[model samples]
Target: MKLHNISFNNLRRRKTKMAFLTIGLVVGIATIVTLVTLTNSMSSDIGRKMDEFGANILITPQQNGLSMNYGGISLGGVNFDQKEIRESDLALISTIRNSRNISAVAPKVVGAVEVDRHQVLLVGVQFDKELKLKQWWNVFGKAPERGDELLLGSEAARVLNVMSGDTIDIKGEKFKVSGILDQTGSQDDSLIFSQLPVAQRLLHKEGRLSFVEVAALCSGCPIGDMVLQIAEKLPAAKVSAIQQVVEGRLKTLDQFRRFSYAMAGVVVFIGSLIVFVTMMGSVNERTTEIGVFRAIGFRKSHIMRIILLEAAVVGVLAGVLGYAAGMGGAKLALPMMAEGKQVQLVWDGVVAAGSLGLSVVLALLGSLYPALHASKLDPTEALRAL
Candidate 1:
């Protein structure tokens, strides 16, 4: 019979032993696949949440300033020739090469207004954009949707002694308190928010913007390139990335990826060890069989081929089964791992191909020594055990 025929017959006769070897390989491959798939899903989910966290880019009017401090003494400098960033100029941001990375753009106009003889920072914002940009805001009431409505911060509401549905006067304009934000421990807690057009008119700075907040942190997004592009597009505006925020989000996602790879590496090593030990034991048990083949005019190469062919078949079988099992495990584990976050399972052809190839390579490498030992066995010596 041919070498492959002999290999197939041996596998059929030793079904239990082969089954154990296959199981070992399958477990290892499955563990690796599950980790990789789960990591990718979790990373995607976290990326979406990070995008909702807040803006990582800030754009403001450009101004020239001079430092007057000397000998570390307290001194104030003058800012001159300040340039305003037109509300219309914000459209140039959408023309950037990486503009698709931009998530939300919130432009604001700011000015101080008096309420009950107390000066309060009043901010004009596009509520639709602001609500989308600040997803974490838990307003006690509702967002302001009308120019005659206002959203007050927790501290601002407390100072003004107002709640939802209360009316307050600003610059001779009466606005109803639409909502009071929950305490966020930020500067926002002391500010009053109103519709963009209303605030612009109230501040008498129509068609002008104080600053813009851009949510542009996405997977593999080039924050630096975007900043430069925005600066180029709006020459009178200062565009900058919030480095700490960008680095923190990137580092978090990277940590998850690195951790999955590290775990996969450990499982691979154990898998290799399992294959080596099992194949070596099988070779020892088949010494007499190998001797018979040698005595029957079968060459050393033929004996080696029979042993390796068996491993190759097992590898192929294990690869298919392992990939299926791994994907299932990832699906089941996602909910618990993601803590209720919705994650879509990915069926990657590349990952499937990779797993198959890895299994085959590991099997061949692990069985190499045993195949060599079997081929080198002295026919007479091996036959004596029979």
Candidate 2:
């Protein structure tokens, strides 16, 4: 009999066993697919959040008395005098030789202000410069044109029960609401933006900026090193990068990714064992059939090929079905997993092909040992057991 015919007949005869083995493999493949998908999605999500923050490098006054301990040892905090960046420092940055990607620079002076019963963050920003930051802000009216005009974040607008053309009292000074930025689910969505001079005046801060938001021209540049270089040049002002903060969070997430990978490995290992045992059991139950094949002059090599072919067919079929099911499962579960955060899954053809390829390889590995054992069976011993 042809190897193909023998394999097909064996699979049909042991339908229940094949079905169980396939289910085990499908579970493992689905798990692996979900983890990989989530890992990629999270990386993209973190990058998007960083982009919304606008500034690649953030400059802030170093906080006092922060310390850390390692190996049961404590290290004292490095203290530096608090100094604000001047307009001269901004100009100096513009002149740096390798700072070509320094696109837009804006200084922010943040403070607290009371509007009726509401306490809000008062942000003094350069209106013209902030436009180059990003597309985070969509003004409902016009951008701030003068000291009297202010833009509120969407949440802030809803809280204050005010909109465009309305005036809100901040620290007893009335300012016209010129615009309201669309919500981006960040710190910006809770603050008020006004001309820097206006904010400084309202907050009683003169010629002093709390921090400078510097938008870099290059997206994938090494921002931490750039921040360090900037800090070295402007010894008076401290520098912080948005990428640094995002990377710190990503490090923590890396631990979770490792855990997910380990879990997937465990699940796949168990699934492979189940497939091996199931195939072995099917071989034992079909000993009489094997004897009949040997009687019909089937070569040992042909029997081996039949067993392996059955395994390969089962593996491929399960892999395709598992991939389809995994994709569908991810689509349905992504939003729920994100906990109301806006997320997007970008499907790459390469990733999909790789995932399916991995599934096939795993399936074949799972069936190899069982297929070998079945191929080595003695027809005389198999018939005697039957």
Candidate 3:
């Protein structure tokens, strides 16, 4: 019989053992595939949300004192200089080399003030640049075109029971409401926007700004490093990278993913053990057949090859099936996992190739002991066994 025929016959004769071996491989492959796919999808989901925040960098006035605590445990705070950034600082940032991504800049001046019966936050914004910074803002009516007209966020409009074409009193001065913005679930949703000059004059701080919002051209930009370098140059201003603010949460998610991968490794290890036991049992049951092959001048290497081929077949089938199942599960679960945010699923080719290769190698390793025993079988002793 040909070598292929021998392998096929051997597997058919030991159906129970083959089934058990395949099951073990399937378990291992499934765990690895699911965890890897989920992790990759999750990282991409987070990155997309961060991009929605618009600016890559945020320049803010340094806070004087702040502290955080958990369960009565207090952590110290770093004292920061509270100097406000000027238009000259904005000009300086614009001059940095490799600053092509710095698209539009807008300074914000925030203060608490009373608008009619309700107290609200007043945010000063430049008309042309503010529109660029808040591109997602949906306006119900006409946007503010003059100093006398102001735009209210959805939440603020609701609180004041006001709408576009209404008038509201701020600091004893009546202002016309020109627009109401859509809800964004952000701080902006609770504030009102007006001309920067009007805000600075009302707040009694002319030519001063609380922070600068910088919209960067995200394509092929190393935003985090650029923000840091810009911060170093402007020692008086505090630079905040939007990416860094959310990096801690991202890191925590990454650790969770690593833990999942570790658990998958354990599952694969158990699968390897199952393969070893099943293969060993098959070798014991086929001792007489092995002896027949030996007597017919089949080399020990040929016997070893047949056993390894059976393992390889099981591994490949398991890998292909598991990969298919894992991808289906990911597609179904991604929406739930991301809390209604639609995230793109990326099947990393490197990960897929590596997983398939590892599965095959693991199967070969599991078959090693059985292959060795078959190779060293004594033909005389095996022929007398039955």
Candidate that scores best on TM-score:
1
Where's the lowest-lDDT run of ten residues in candidate 2? Answer: 216-225
TM-score of each: 0.82, 0.68, 0.74
lDDT of 2 by residue, 229-330 (tens): 788778887787666565666776687689778988897788778777887787777778777777678777777777778877887877777777777777
- Sliding window of 10 residues with minimal summed lDDT for model 3: 216-225
Can you write out model 1's per-residue Cα lDDT over 332-359, one digit (the tens) per residue?
9988877465677778898899999999
Residue pair clashes in candidate 2 = 58-240
Which scores greater on lDDT, model 2 or model 3?
3
Give lDDT tens digits, candidate 3, residues 1-386.
78877788878887887877777787777677777787788877766555555776888876686777878888776576567777567777877765786767888888889876677889899878878766778898978999999999999999999999999988888899999998888887899999988998899878788898887634346777778777877777788767655666577777979898798889778888888888898899889989988998999999999999888887787777767776777777777776455688878887677667767887888899999999999999999986
Relative to the unseen true structure, what is the C-alpha lDDT of residue 20 in candidate 1, on a scale of 0 to 100? 91
What lDDT is obtained when candidate 2 is compared to the true structure?
0.77
Question: What C-alpha RMSD separates each model from the true structure?
Answer: 3.8, 7.6, 6.3
lDDT of 1 at 234: 95
Residue 307 in model 3: shift from native, Å? 1.1
